[model samples]
Target: MRKKYLFIGLFIFAILFTFGCTSGNNPKDSFQKYVDAWEKQDYKTMYTFLSPSSKKSISEKDFIAKYTNIYNGIEVNKISVAPDYPKSFKKDSDGNTSIPFKVTMSTVAGNIKFNDTAYFSNNTKDSSNPWSLNWNIKMIYPDLNTDDKIRIDKTFGKRGEIKDANGSYLAQNSYIESVGIVPEKLGADAENSKKQIADILKIDKGVIDKALSASYVLPDMFIQIDNLSMDDTDRLSSLAKIPGVMLKKTPARVYPLKEKAALLTGYVQPISADELKKLSSQGYSKDDSIGKSGLEKIYEKQLKATDGAEIYITDKEGKKLKTIVKKTEQNGKDINLTIDSNIQSALYDQYKVDSGTAVAMNPKTGAVLALVSAPGYDPNDFVLGMSKDKWNSLQNDPNKPLLNRFQATFAPGSSFKPITAAIGLKTGKLDPNADKNISGLKWQKDSSWGNYYVTRDAAYNSPANLLNALVYSDNIYFAKTALDIGKDNFINETKKFGIGKTLPFEYGLDASKISPDNSIKDDIGLADSGYGQGQVLMNPVQLVSIYTSFVNNGNIIAPYLNAAKGTPGKILESNVFSQDISNTILNDLTQVVSNPAGTGYGAYMPNLPLAGKTGTAEIKKSQTDTTGTENGWFIATNTNNPKLLVLEMYENVKNKGGSHYVVPNVKSIFEQFCK
Candidate 1:
């Protein structure tokens, strides 16, 4: 019995030993473990699967370095390994085993798919040898060989063009010479060469030195100077002869409208280091040009193109061996605006001497036809690299050319009388036909309010109703009407018109303020607001929107630059006025331009019936003290079409007349386009 028990024990021990050997020598298990480590980027665990001979040839640090270097050039979004790719192990006659794998890597450049084999071996002659992988770089990329590496080549996509409503180019890419200096070629005369280049380019010599001093710039690399106009062939030829100077034609953003549309179209500049880091996930490089302001900045993503990429294997000397992947770059989408270039040019031409803004829109649809801000600068100056002196001149100019006057706020003056009239009619505080019988060229405010007095032009002393009051721009009549409506009703009516609220526009707008806190506390304040005087500030765009309600059956549609036939404009305030009130207001505005006694009579066009209001707002030192400086305004609409509304404002008019100064220009614009 003892002998039988010993035999059974020995047999059980042998079976257990056989099972342990089979598990240790399993090549499939070793390859799978190595693949799992690789997928997780656990290089330390991956190194554990390396064969003793392989580890002897390369250290763990070198193994990790090989993969990390390839990863730095590409953004890996995802890595997918096929579960059934390595179906079963295949044994070679030489006792080597291999497992096939299919890996798909999703990257910013696109997807990359490749098939590779992981080799494993077990030395049958050595009793203690376990299954081990003979890993190499080829296992990661099949095309990789000794002294060969994977390289990614990027091709930037074409930027889109900005076109006007008539399909005219506003901003587009044009070929310009990229001037630079090859530092290594400068030799011992680098300083002299830089001075000569700067003199020819009209740039500071320090700019060249700064470029050369960059840590990343190598001696052979070209340090950029500035983009020169293609028409500057004479300068290019002369500069090319100088040592270290080089010129290459490259596509650059160009503003065809230049000074005419500079404030509206804006410009682009090279991305900064901070922008590069923020936009890295979007594939933007430091060399890319991005919109800095205006519409260009607003539609950046739509105007920005997708870059293409080429992946290939390259030798140690950087010669391509084979192309693995190629992708075509997609151009950006073109942006169509509602601006009419011809009308825009006309508007700019008319306001050449004035420092102000003007906007014309389709009252029914709220499509802005033209927007002009005077004292404008050439956007091309920025695109072609503006000089510091020129930039400083623009910045220091008293007129403020860079300021977007369209979005700026100003006192609406008598142009706001219509809104006051509408509020009086809407609140049932004043009758359009009832005789207010207020008689004054100038009327003093009540002693309780202040010693201040409301004054009108000497020609407007007649008894007034709403129509004659608007026609004569009688400040006394309107102020009394506002007082009758009371302060609360006036505040509510103005708020209903979207005052004190920001307009939803792509270019951004300042909220029209009635007061600092949008409230009027005193009778004098109410009286001033009635004449569009007391702390009432409005923007041209928002003012146009308010005027649009009169022609649109009392629905105030927010004005938009990109409104089209199918895209409806946003309705900021609905039913702001009854149709009867709108018609009454329209009729009153018409008489203001048609009647010889009206203040807007200067804007009369014999061929066309025009409806508008004239305003002469005095700039005040305080709410009580009026300055001699005045701002002239004319807000007009065509009665024949009823679809157009134009607002013009000229600042600091001094003694150049009242709203009468801008009336002829408005008439000229109306006759030219409104007809």
Candidate 2:
């Protein structure tokens, strides 16, 4: 009987111990779990922790959706949730627990931080958890309440302006009219009216039909067909009498320089769908404008507008209650270029009729003043909206009006002689005063060259010396000079002038090539390359930069576009040639222009002291091919001030006096700037 009594006592003690443990539940621990789920953006887990009364107020799906939509709309990220609570659990007089918490996150508008209290019910009845959150809209946002809505408001900033060195507009914000048609107002002759519209707008009739046939279009709704610049829309005044034609003025990007600066400034258009998807996180929308080409595209970060945002609480009446986040809109920074508008216009006016490209730069400062690619299409057409027919015409034009020739490379022709001469002098292979015993207008290194031979202008059959060779543009002299320098030495020396390397400039320029794969195959190939023929191609800007070494005491100046980044006299390759060699070459090039017998004599002008070289690069399948074309090249600058260095190239100058065809044209531009 005593043993049974002892067993009963021990069992009762064990039961009491289990009951004590179950009653030791802390509300702070439950609150911590809810805060953790909030930080992870786990709305479902947070919903499961809500009190029965809170759950009855909002459905689980609606709760999760509300958090998601609001967070995404405001671009919320980097979420943090911290709760301020005591070490021990305590209950208020009403049998509830309240814990203060802080919420922080990054948004497009800016950072958001707020503090609020989380209330939990102390009653554990009919629930597995000892604590349940008494959730409400205030728990999501401190300023939010029932029947209140969270809203995001956007304000767009103005796009920046592109200006010349004189602060003249190259590209700027302006106005245009959106031309459209309303089908309901069109008379019985709707097809005829569309034909007339197509003719006026230079568009296809099918384009109008497709736009009107859209599923979203209504008979009275305005169906936009094309846009026209405000300054150029006078031609459309006759369309006002038409039944359905309408013009709505809208903001647009305008190019004042038109075709003259088209390739330099490029143009802007509405952002594409793919671009929007990629840039959504950057606060970019489908309605935003994006740069398409040229400087506009390259400097997009500095020229694009920054949108401002405001996240606020609104009532059912659509009245704003409180602002949770605010960001000020910032306009894009204006870009000032080193381009001189006067020089840019002068070069374009001179080269507009030819199939060629011209570049004028301040050789000493490395400031690229003018870049003109002739047969240019107006950039304003792109901004005003181009029609299918107009676009096709530009694409089909034999002259290739759309090509940015300045960005392309071509054979330097005789223009590359200076480089070869410098290399020859640097390698100590050629004596400037010593005359080479080369004869005839055409010569080759023995019969190993077979039928292939280097030909020179018949006008220059004088004794072959360094000065006379450069002045006469004697191909055989330079070819013989290259043979003396050898292949390995020539290529290694050429690389010092930035060949086979990327140019450090804002504009994209093709790297100047030395030879096929940077290697000369044989003596014939080396001879041809020495005169800038065999795979010796260079962009106009790079050619101008290399020429700068002659005036910069044998140092190549790095060419620059944006005025802000241009450091005057910034050396690209230091000491490419010794001071004595540079001076000698400069004097020889000067004589080529001033002397009547010189090949570059066409460019000679009195009192201007111009120095330059002329080149004619032949394009043919073989050396003996009679049906071949020639590209004319001219590099000229004032030897005194050494300020403006110009390079001009014209295609298909065969039987047109070769490189001399562009020499006079280059001289006229210098007259406008200097004389």
Candidate 3:
């Protein structure tokens, strides 16, 4: 009986010993679990693996603080942990095992690679003596002591220049001197400095006084006075002599073309707080500049540069001990636009009217040569930070200088006659060669078509065919043609031309509406729309696109601004009109400019054979203005080289003589390019 009891006791003791040895020998498994926790930022789970002595030295809260505060400051984006030496754990004579590890951390600053060791030992609290990690700050980052920290420094890349087709600078960075006053540094001369600055810049004295009266004015801080031009170096030298005045040169976005190409080039401004929050993950900082409109806003991602960064290991005193990672910033790629600088300048000069828009494109390839919106404001104003008063003045201007007229809609008037003529021919509703006994003065569907009457000039009183009607721009002729085509076919044919749809353009465009919801309402309404009236609105860009079909033998190609030599034009519609039909329409349009009695005869070039149309749209009086106005429009193409198409529209020509107001400008633009 004694021998049996002794045997059972020895057997149980042997089993307990076996379990303790197995748990203590598996240090690699314990180290792997701890590494997994660290990678996930689960400090609590990591802390559970710490040996009894390690936990006593550093609490879980302190362990988490090390990762969240110090590590996060470096902008760590990713962390990867792997065995540094061998997969097996190394045992020391002290009954402890060490698992070597290689940690690579990817951060905004750069990649930081380092070696660390996680020590494991049998826990004193466990009777089984299970292996546990002897954790410490050193296990995460090598040589990371309580008084040491990680520091990161960022360097922004330089913005690229915007150049025209000829490589002339449109938008570029320039150095300007910012003059300001340091009030506290002025001592007894604060009042004198303010007066001197105001006098030198010819600015109001109250402006300087208000700037100095700020509650948070600091002695060493700068209070901006003005941004001095580079040409104002002499003035800057004189201003710097003021007691408390300081002048610092800083880089600024500048439009070398100024107001000439302002509408197309656009401008940039400091990013708002909301923008920063949304773009934070893209590495956008508070001080970054962002594009606000036009081409600048459209290609922001391509124009934006890649930011570089540097990471430093530093002591508590803020002295950088060594740089862990360094990266060089890559400058942004320069953008080359398709606009011809000379043609653009000529177009702007010829648009002498106060408010209007014009667009010229290659009819064959659809490459836009020039685009202009009159009453343009200098983009430099926005870039240099426009004052509240100046901004309000521009916003309130009657001409709407900030509006991009090229994208804004206008009643096409008789300029839309060609489209109406096309619809009539396509639907077999009108005979191009046969003469119609249409009234020149007035016409209506019938007596029951209400009191609505389509009136025309008495000059069109003679028997008229398609050719003669187009030359005279007889409103009655086109209106009669639209009614004959019927409402459903008219709407469907117009839709085929992409009317009432938003044009696909890189620079945004407002959709042209035939009429809201394509509704013609009644026979009179349909007739009114025939001559580009009754809710029919078209933008200059789309108008040029529609005209290109006549030039390209009735194959409509959507106009594009940024086409290279071999880039094929996108075909919007095929077989819009047969070759014979397109030729007949082209011949009739040519007579409008070539014929002596044609309305567009004034737009004829001396040597260039021009083909085009003219229009005059009436505007109704509105609450904003008591006087109604007329919008003059003209579109033409060179008869020899049909690829060159020009479109011009003049606004608010109340008493102006019909389409005659736009003829000279259109002629001048063609002369510049064709001659």
Candidate 4:
């Protein structure tokens, strides 16, 4: 009996010892070894721990390159690991091992400190039931300890939707399917067929060849192909079956009415090498495309979206064995706009091929009705990696095709009369009923015209109310008005109306439009200011704003870019002033079109009480060619609802163009839309 008891005990001890030995060699131990290997830069050992599929899909060279790039970006602070990893198991549910992780990172965000908030989690399904893990590997935001993530987590977070006032889609996101080629499978003769493919795709032959030849790229990848136009897509995909191509699925940025608001919506240009360096400084990778310009740049944070990823193990034969790790990608915010896309389309058509800009606004609320910038390019041109030729064409075009001229600064010509009139009225220089005579001024230094042109004009011209000055667009009348208002007072008043200043609206540049010249021609320049000419500069919206102040009875509301309240980086900084214009000035303007003898009577809205000013500017010439010389402008507001403010102008037009030509178009637009 004693011998049997001893044998049983020995047998039990042996079984316990065997169990301990097997557990010691389990996946958990292998995962720990992998972590240590990574810390020591034993890349070869780490490579051994990677799943077989990962090894095949990505080589050690690729892995090293990715690691190096991430390390360089994260060297600012190397995160330290905890003494014990929290509830961590090195193995996944299927007894498959995981990549090792053991620490948390923290940062200051606004008022809160987020600790490992950018968590990388994987819920990998395995063949084995009741599978659980210790700690999973994470590629947290800018963490030095982990690799840079490869996925943009769409399921994790999403951006808001962008739409127009009538619920028209200005910009939106949709799932897309794409294609790629296996470079290694490409035959040597494949290079010879490049021209044939290029011809088929209607793209430059050199571009196709270059894309095919780049290393670390799919041989014939459709990295970015247009998701629209099924006719061409069907044709192209059939041609790509030439030897070594494969199909891929992905999501792409699609702007449906891409041509309608090309400049206003902006384009997405690819990053140059310099841009990559800049982005790296900001903790972003080359793969990312943030906003470049237009509403895109102005609201990048809200529009930026990311896709998430998961890392997993694969068997020796190349089957996915386990999900080593995972993290989801986040999407950018949605944007909504105040733009009436239909009106925008209508305005674009009005330009036809003319190089001009048109902008309409709601005088009561300052909502933009339509915005058009001519010599435009399709925003789609930049979407799928802009070619050098197309990009250069846009960049070198003298017309400035990319500029949103609705917010561009140009000499207002006579169109600025109303703004000057407002300045005159607000500064108490001239009453609406006070007629100021135009008199000639002597030059401080005598030139071709001698001391003076002796241009005799009237002050208190009984017929010369503010409306009369605007009607005749009398240059000398406004000249006296400007001098009466004085330079300092005039500048201040213009600035208040958002002239000579960056508008709170996003469509303008940093520099204000005030021209700098300090001479008597400049005084005559002030004369021109009365009629929207001389040193005075303003954009389309400024006309809208100034006219609003006039027609809205001295109330000035700042312009609105988007009607949606939650655009990512866009915040409306509009201003509204409560000042009042006299009943007298409003009456004179109202009668400008109603009165038959008035210059602007031809511009009357048939059924509505309307007031407007016309400006014809002699574009200062440095050349003998009078072709495309000056600008023609007209501005108007509907008195009944004051709901619409329209400004239209044409440049370098035929028939020695002036404000008359544009008045018809403005009247047409106002007549058609205001109702």
Q: What is the lDDT of residue 301 in candidate 3?
A: 84
**Across residues 1-675, which tens digit of lDDT does each residue of candidate 4 receive?**
999999999999999897765534334455556556555555566665555445565677866676555444323122333223334435445555433344432111001111331111222343221222232233323222233242211133444456778887776654344434455555677675555555555677677556666675754444432233322467557656665555454444556676668777775544566776555444334456656777777776677655344443343454564443354566677777888887788777777767788888887777887887886887655655566777899899987787677766777776676667767776778787765544333111126434433121223344655767665656666767877887677766766766555666655553345565322344544544555555666767766665666655466666777776423222222232224553555566666667775556777866887777766666755223355477777777788867877787788654644667777777777777878
Give the C-alpha miss distance for residue 437 in model 3, angstroms: 1.8
User: Quick one: best lDDT, which candidate?
Assistant: 2
Better of 1 and 2 by TM-score: 2
Q: Candidate 3, residues 26-122: lDDT per residue as tens digits?
A: 6766777777877887778878888888889988898788777756776665677996545555678987787778888766666789987777886
What TM-score goes with each of the models?
Answer: 0.77, 0.80, 0.78, 0.68
Per-residue lDDT of model 1, residues 565-593, tens digit only: 32455677999989999999999999999
| Higher-lDDT candidate of 1 and 2 | 2
lDDT (Cα, tens digit) per residue for candidate 2, span 71-133: 888877558888888665577887777788888887778879999988888655744776788
lDDT, candidates in the order shown: 0.83, 0.87, 0.81, 0.59
TM-score of 2: 0.80
| CA deviation > 4 Å runs, candidate 1 | 1-108, 111-143, 181-197, 206-223, 231-246, 315-327, 386-395, 459-461, 563-572, 623-628
Which candidate order results from sorting by lDDT in descending order? 2, 1, 3, 4
